[model samples]
Target chain A: MLLNKIIREKINSKLMLTFTILSCLLVVLIFFGLYYKSSPLFTNNSIKDLLFSSEWFPLKGKFGLLPFISSTIWVTLISVIIAIPFSLLTAIYLTEYADKRFVRMINPLIDILAGLPSVIFGIWGVIMIVPFIKNHIAPALGISSGGYCLLAGGIVLAVMILPVIIHVVSEVFRAIPQDLKNASLSLGATQWQTIKYVVIRKSMPGIIAAIVLGLSRAFGETLAVLMVVGNVVKMPHSVFDPAYPLPALIANNYGEMLSIPLYDSALMFSALILFVIVLIFNVISRIILVRIERSLGIG
Target chain B: MDKRKIEESIFKILMRVATLSIVISLAVILISIIYKAIPVMNWGMISQTPQGGFYLGENGGVLNAILGSLYLATGATILALMLSFPIVFYINIYAKKGSWFVHTVRLCFDILWGIPSIVYGAFGFSIMILLGMRTSLFAGIIVIALVILPIIVRALDEVVRMIPQGLLDASYSLGATKTQTSVKIVTRQALPGLITAILIAFGRGIGDAAAVLFTTGYTDNVPTSLFDSAATLPLAIFFQLGSPVEAVQNRAFASALILTIIILSISILARYFSGKYNKFKV
Candidate 1:
């Protein structure tokens, strides 16, 4: 027994030591991966120009990533504009108005929606969604034919993100303690009034977190937007115009990186810029998520 | 009372409309994909390689991509599990206090989780490209493992941490070896959760397209080694959709359905594993 006890203690110590090493190794590797891959494009002078320059012409040796940035922002903005309403309305209905059984049914449906891969969604968009917009939605708005356009991409993105936002917001609403609901009801508040005045107020941080998460995801979304968004590098005149985002630019254009020094560097530079944007967005979302956890005492 | 009841009914109706539409849309999308896919699905699509366009339902299969996905994903899944469990165990067990080491590692995983898959793709691309490997099967395997590591770590961390400390103490007090306690007592307790973690990582790895799109250079031909170019199922769908042939379109739809079914099955199995494990503990 004494020998076994000593053996157990030794094993525990070894396990602890091993785990520590693994964590450090992975973190180091990730940073190394980023810095190592991005070194070619990160020289001090060109870094500034790549980030701040107004125009992006890789073929002419001008490689600013601003167009991809603005294009990403534009499509993301349009998507949030459409998705925010649908998600909020859906959240309110699910939490404040729907019956318990109905809520159960809808929640899993949303989970399944969330699990749907972006590639399948892209296929759906290219085949079914693009044509629908070209023949019906676009012309109805008096726009030129653009089955593949910013509007189509944004809408598909909105649909893809709706479940995530709705899931987060509804969870927030559900997390509000029953006592708060009872108190609101006892004060003679209507269901809507209770939800608005009490429930939403209490869950404000979570709602913000949900919004931030949605924005972060919308900004970072790739295949869905890449497949639908017409790969036009120019600025959009309307939602119907084609757009190319940073993700698409890197994904599609990077492979064609031979025989041109400027073009190859341009792809790497855009990748670096994308890294920065995603990092900032993730930080903001983390802040909001932390606040939600603190406010709800759930962290 | 009557007026209040009427107002309640109106609100209920509004809720019904919004909730029902969302549900209906989800169903419609699933049914639509299945409807498109089932008719075109055949054994040959699984066994054969693409000869021409599979859109009009007349071409070859997704043999290389299918085999590549399974082989690479299986490799990645195994690698991720080997890397994950030890880290998760160390973090949860040894780093209970707000120690600098533990805190930094935890933050690293958090940041890694949100880092875009494209960035991983970029990193993997440079390394692979430099190594004279552009779009090889090994590239897909490594990047997918890295991409899903954060999620697997998080899930496994939670699972391992939940193994009660008493069990550890009890085993030790009874004179068991440390390895015995860890491998036999704690890990046994964490079986269901570990399964959940693995399933989650496997699901993410198999479904990835964008991260691997450039790295796993498109290859219609079957790969004979980790160095060979390969297409995954998601790549198959994307390439097929863009092809001009009607046969390619049909194959794309069928492949999409197959992908959906694969994802759905993984999710279901994951849920069951998690739930059953938790239930068993209770």
Candidate 2:
């Protein structure tokens, strides 16, 4: 019986280890798979021209991704700029100032927002934000826009990522020992002073990691941004200008990629770019998060 | 001292405003969708498939998309569970504490969790091209399974990690092998979390649009087989909203309402069951 049990145990462990290794290898496979599919584009055009040039005409084989890349950057940057302050303040409020019952009430609301489908957000953007911008905000600012522009995409994305940022940042805040807050309080520091000097200082790395993760998420969002951001293939000089983000480009054009020469390859290349960028951001944030957890003795 | 007090009050108001804004946005989104959908939402909306000229504001419902999403999410959840259970079990039960392999696997999962679904869509499309396969429910299931695999594994791993080591030790002292102990003790302890994880993954799978957009070609009819094209609710909303007709746009809001209800209920169920089941855990 002992021998039989030992054999079974060995077999089970080996089987599970195999699955674990395979799962890890799957990520690498995705990278290589995307690269292989996009390799054809590299042969005909240099990476510099493909990424730098602004012209994009599939019929004549001119695929410049600068407009898409720039639009993605502008939209993501705008979202981060708008979202960081609001989310940070919200996190601070929930963690430091709010009562337990209040926080509990808000938590579920945040969960609902986070669980909401991106398509719903897209619809909400179309019906609400687009018209509000076109009819109200644009004219007030002495500018004219058709409602579908980079600003609309940024606003939609900011709302979408708010819950994510708040969740991470508040968790970090909660992880701080109560004794540390008490120590600051005992030093005659007001709540805001303690938060400004101690809580924010201690959680800076975590806050940054949360923002990076949020930015990564904003970069990859497709349908919502696709719906609001006018899919115009040009550089966006201002927030009210139309833009086509990288994920939107892939989502919009992949269905019709088969008719033109190397169209599939170009779209695949854009997907590859998104994949790499998200991977890098995720890795950077993971490193920071792990380090913070280790320093806090919670890992 | 007075200046510091004033500064504190000012910052407090700012934080309150920030929190209120987020809550207000959630309310706005929910209310707007509900308001727009109420007029169009009827028994027929959920009961029948699209008829001819349905996109042109003719009589029909999103029954095809509703059924397709159900079938797709269900299949993807099952597949993801199969794949995730083994990996999560290996990481928590079989691997040594702080093992390099465990660290690497966890890191990979974290990265996978962050990858955008659109990239997954493109990747799935490439896989289809390689296999010479057409867009079908099967392809969508495969792609969504990949999308949710990390979610299930990470959630399950978090629960499994919290299982008391003493429980496993006691089982081992009783001559229980690691396999026996894991299959019985660890799984039982993690059951609540596992269920919650599954529900969460299902919600994500069903609500997702980008990953399945290219993999599952939308159809007006409900798919009878895995090889048939499937129209998901998210895509239905997208396609319907794209129409310039008022009726078609209203249908999009109604579809969005249905999807929201499904997702919200799943999340609530996950939380409720997890709390109720936690009492059974030692």
Candidate 3:
């Protein structure tokens, strides 16, 4: 009996140790894989040329990533801009002004929205938004092109990102001490005043973190944006122009990457850039959130 | 004071508009999907595999894709559970609360959670190339398991963390080993949330197209082994929509409708279970 018990204990400890280390080990392996695969880009190319050049022809031996870099930045910025106001107001309403019954009904809806597949959004974007833009909005705006452009991509991304920003911001709003709002209200502040002076001030850090996280999501979104964004490898002059972002560039070209000299390396380089940017955004937001939790004495 | 009242009312209107827009957008999405998908969604399209030139408006079905998605998601979710439950159990039972190691591990997971699915695919593609592996069900499973691992761990961690510390103390006072306490008390307390987490991860894994685009390497056949290239509902929709033919495009919507129904049912089931658990607790 004692020998069996000892063996059981040994097995327990071994299992625990192995599982705990597996997470860290997998992360390290992924990082090493990306780093090792991306190393070839540095051999024949200067980092400056990769970042600044607009020409990206593998046949002609020019590997400028300026077009994709600009596309990614522009699309991300536009999507975030479109998403923030609606998300902020919705969050504020749900947490502060809405009735409890209403909040209860909407909360699950938001969760459902968050969990819906991106492909659904992609299909909607292609069938609904693209044609609507091409037939109505584009002509009205005097832009002569198919609607498969940066604008469609941004709008779809905004819809996909809305739930994420709203959820996080609302959570932050919920975390604010109720007594602070009560004090503001009892001091003769209006409802909006209480929100502006008490709730927003306390949760500003968390809200910023939420927006940054949303931006990271928008930056790395693929497939939906891929379906909408016309994969023309050029710098778009306007939101209506077809342009290729980094993720789309990688997804579109990586299948045939080995065919062109340095093609695979350049695509790997793009992936590395995307990975690093997302990491930086996520880390920054996490640090800020940790600080917020520490200050508030919540975890 | 009067000015402030007017501003408050205006702000209220803005907030209502913002919230209503969300409702409206969701309504629009559903309405459009149903209207477009109804015509093409039929019995045969869902039951048979493709024959010749399926992308050219030919008569074929998404049976391979539906079955492949089921196999891929089930495999990945099981793999993720095997990896995540142990880690969660360790952090809760063996390690001290708020330890540096726990903090670092949580931080790493938060970072992983934010990393895009495409990035996971790209990273997985590189590793696959290094191992001289082709795109197959196995590659999809590994990459997708990695992608959903953080979600499962973080969700289950939150659930387990909510189990009162006193429960652990109580179990210890009764002379239970750490393993026993964790396995019995912690698992019991967190079972419902664990189900919810798995549902969420399954939905995520099954719906995701980017992570498996290159890794899974789509095929029209049901995957017979881990090495077989598998078609998925999302990729089927993607390829069908890419076609210039109208009928093929309609089939894309049909495929999407099927996927949406599957995801919606899973979520509803998740909500029902969690709600039931909450009532039982109270």
Candidate 4:
């Protein structure tokens, strides 16, 4: 027993370190994998060469991530722009105006919506929505191929992200102390005005956090966009035009890559860009949350 | 009063329209999916192998996939739990000095939760390719579990943390061994959290399609072993979307509805149990 105890005592630190290293390595490996796959695309000097060279031709050995980066931002902006108002308004109604009973009723329903798997949304978009758009909505919009257009994907994505945005924003709104709401109303601000100015302002960090989370979520979604967004290589012009996003590009080609070096590297490059974007969003959200926590004086 | 009331009425109507549209869409989606998905619910659809292409349809029953998802997720969750519980327990209980490391891990895990499944999928794809199991269920489960470990740890920590420090003080004063106190007393307090954590992971795994898709490509047969390739409900939806036939699309809808229900039920159950625990404690 003494010998066994001694052995455990000696090796315990080793065990702990192993687990810690594994966790840290998982995070590190994601970055390393990106660099390893995308090494062929290095164009110039350290910072400017890696990020700003403005040329991404993996096949031709020119690596330009700017266009893909810009396209992603565009899609994210479009989805968020459509989602924010609806979500904010919904949060307002749920938290500020609705009765507790009514709020309880709506809350779980929205929670369920948030929990709907992305693949299901992909199926719905592909089987029903895209075709519906192509046959009905597209004719009205005057788009060419109704299948993979940006508008269709954006709208589906907006709906997929709606429940998340509303649920998070509502929770943030609900967290605001009741006195704040009462304080606004006491100053002759109407209920709507109170919600708009006081409650909303107090919840801005959380609301922004929610939006950034949504952007991250939208940025990484694969199946929904893959099935609906036409995997066109060229940059997309309008929401009406068809274009591929980063994750979709990775999913479509990763499994069946006949073109060895370039295709695989391109997929990895997009993955790298995505990893960088998500990492930035995460860090920013953490810093903002810490600031909010400090300002609130309670966590 | 007349003109202002008239404008207020218009705004109210507009708000009502917008709210109703959201509600209507929600209902319409459920109804459309359920109605379409009803025909695909036969047991035979699962029991058999992919056979005569339903008019140039993909071959194979999803039997292997169902078993594969179950075992792989189970295995991964078990691995995650074993790794997390002891380490998190030590940090939370004994190694107070290592709080920073623990907290940093917790933070990364939280960041991990916010990450959409595709990044995890890419991570799995990378690891799996190295293991030479490019389209395997083990890869799928590892991705799912990695994505969910933080959730389990957080929930377990919350449950344990809420156990009054008084209990630990009492046990130690009574000369109880730390191991005895942890196994018998500390983890008992955390049982609810552990269950909640498992359910949370299950719920997340059940809903996650992206990570599993790349790691475990769409195989119709449910996997009987951990090492085999297979599909799950999430992947089924993605796979069926590209099918040329309407019947297959309907099957996807039905599968989607089933998947949503499973996710929804677990979430609802978690809420109920957690709420009950709160009330019981109060």
Model 1 agreement with the true structure over A1-299: per-residue lDDT tens digits: 77767776767777767755665575456556655655666563376677667577666767766667777888888888888877887898988776789777777678778778888778778767789999998888887767888887888788788897998898788778899999999998787668768988887877877776777677777888899998987866788888888888887776577666656656665666666666676666666665665577763
In Å, candidate 2's interface RMSD is 0.8
The residue-by-residue lDDT of candidate 1 on B1-282, one tens digit each, is: 767667766766765766677777677678778888888889888889877644455668988778777777787888777777667666665455446666567666776776778777876776776788667888788888888888888777667767777877888798766566667776778888888778767777878887888777777788898888887988888878777777677888888887888888988898878777677672
**Highest DockQ model number:** 2
Structure candidate 2, residue pairs in collision:
none
lDDT string, candidate 4, A157-263, tens digits: 88778887887777677677889888887987766667667887888998898888788878877777777777776667777677777787677777654365556
Provide TM-scores for the models.
0.89, 0.99, 0.97, 0.87
Between the candidate structures 1 and 3, which one is better when assessed by DockQ? 3
lDDT of 2 by residue, A96-122 (tens): 999999999999899889989899999
Task: Give the TM-score comparing model 4 with the true structure, all chains together.
Answer: 0.87
Model 1 CA deviation exceeding 4 Å by range: A1-48, A52-54, A95-100, B1-15, B52-58, B97-104, B130-134, B163-169, B175-180
Best by lDDT: 2
Query: Per lDDT, what order, best first?
Result: 2, 3, 1, 4
> Which pairs, if any, clash in model 3?
none
Model 2 chain A: worst 10 consecutive residues (lDDT sum): A290-299
Q: What lDDT tens digits, residue by residue, belong to model 3 across residues A1-299?
A: 76776688678867886877777676666667787887777777789999999978888767899999999998899899999999999999999889999999888877877888888998999988999889999999887879999999999999889999998899889889889999999999998999998899989999999999999999999888999989898888999998899999998887789998888878888888898899899999999888877777986
* Each model's lDDT: 0.76, 0.93, 0.89, 0.69
